[model samples]
Target: MYARLFPIIAVLAALLAPAAAASDLTVFAAASMREAMERIASGFEEETGTKVVFSFAGTGVLARQIEAGAPADLFVSADADWMDYVTENGSIDAASVRQVASNALVLVGASGAAALELEASKIADFLDDQRMAMADPDTVPAGRYGRTALENLGLWQSVAGRLAPMENVRIALASVARGDTPLGLVYRTDAEIEPNVAVLATFPDTSHPEIRYLAALTEGSGNPAAEPFLDYLTGPDAREILQSLGFVTDKVE
Candidate 1:
């Protein structure tokens, strides 16, 4: 069911706090990029001696924070629409926008759970009366993609009220990994990092809009490291990290 998630108010407050010191670069990135982005930032810190700080959240939340002057040096979003939102609102420099990576959507369950067909009638059978966890389908990119996949396959009606939607893709992944939810829908990259979750099925690329990760330097950011870090994210090293984490780094589409 669609549960209200007002608890995020506290989270938003923290993310919207004052900007970082000039010596450190502040980045607001999508939740699904946590592990990979951390690894990449660590490498950047080692190589350039510039510290990188991050605020990871859903694309919708990050975009809103940026719009309200979150003071982030950079913004990376899983959904292009959210990036467009920030860009249109003057939160980020539109000219610096670039597609960094692409990802696939997947259905996952507890590690030992059996896999099932990605069919319309079979979805309910697969759920087995338990709610399938998902990101907030209305605003979150992964959730929106999952819902669109189900709708495209005529399975939306079957799972209508049978959801345990969370705030972001990572939370949904965590829920299934911890056995709090038997099933969840998340990015392939997100599923790979959690050993306790098994990929039950992958959503067809045609089932939803293209899944692309876009990065950009925040509009009028005076921090010198901002542009460099954004470039590093799309560099070979970052691409390698993204591919190792199961993200499609070959092309943005």
Candidate 2:
């Protein structure tokens, strides 16, 4: 009886050990992607029987961390520039890099804020005294695009004084949503999640650089689980999840 019980327990442990080990994948992603990525990660874990751990922050900040030898299996950057930084530093696999999604910049105003309208002409009048929030253009891609759009529309020079720089796009969006700033330039997905903000207008494609979200595996991860997650990201199910979240799927482009 003791011998039979011992053999059964050994078999059970062997079956469970691999499942337990597979449940630990570390993913570093952009702060603006937190909400959407978390939801997708949960779904991925459920389907693949893997656990996901995430670190979220500005793409530039995350890139620096990766360059400094942070142990991350995967990276999802808010823009291509930071991903390039990682690849240039030999921190990520250049061949594994892929454009996963696209985001649009939008002017978001506080709920019921009448000072700003979507029209180009009204933007100038709206900028006269109202404070506008933005991320630091030097370190944040969304902010850089915001500045470019303003400069292209001839608003940056006139409204530069009223600009309030935040740490990241999500922070800028929060400022407007919370009424700390009357308006902000943020991703359409960011605006969509904030019920307290109204989208004034989406920046025309010609107004600024195209916003591309890129993903890649970090170098030296060597985790067998990492490739599966990457494959899941490019699969049909993940594309559907991205599309549902207002992210433009690669198929659309």
The numbered model that scores best in TM-score is: 1
Candidate 1 lDDT over 47-133, as tens digits, reads: 999999898988887887777667789998998888898888777899999998999999999887788788766778877878999
lDDT of each: 0.86, 0.79
Point to the candidate with the largest lDDT: 1
124-237 per-residue lDDT for model 2 (tens digits): 677667778988777788888888988897777766777888878989998888878877989999988889999877788899878888889999687888888887877787
Worst 10 residues of 2 by lDDT: 13-22
The alpha-carbon root-mean-square deviation between model 1 and the true structure, to one decimal in Å, is 2.6
Q: How far in Å is the alpha carbon of 180 misplaced in model 2?
A: 0.6
lDDT of 1 at 145: 89
Q: Candidate 1: deviation at residue 171, Å?
A: 0.7
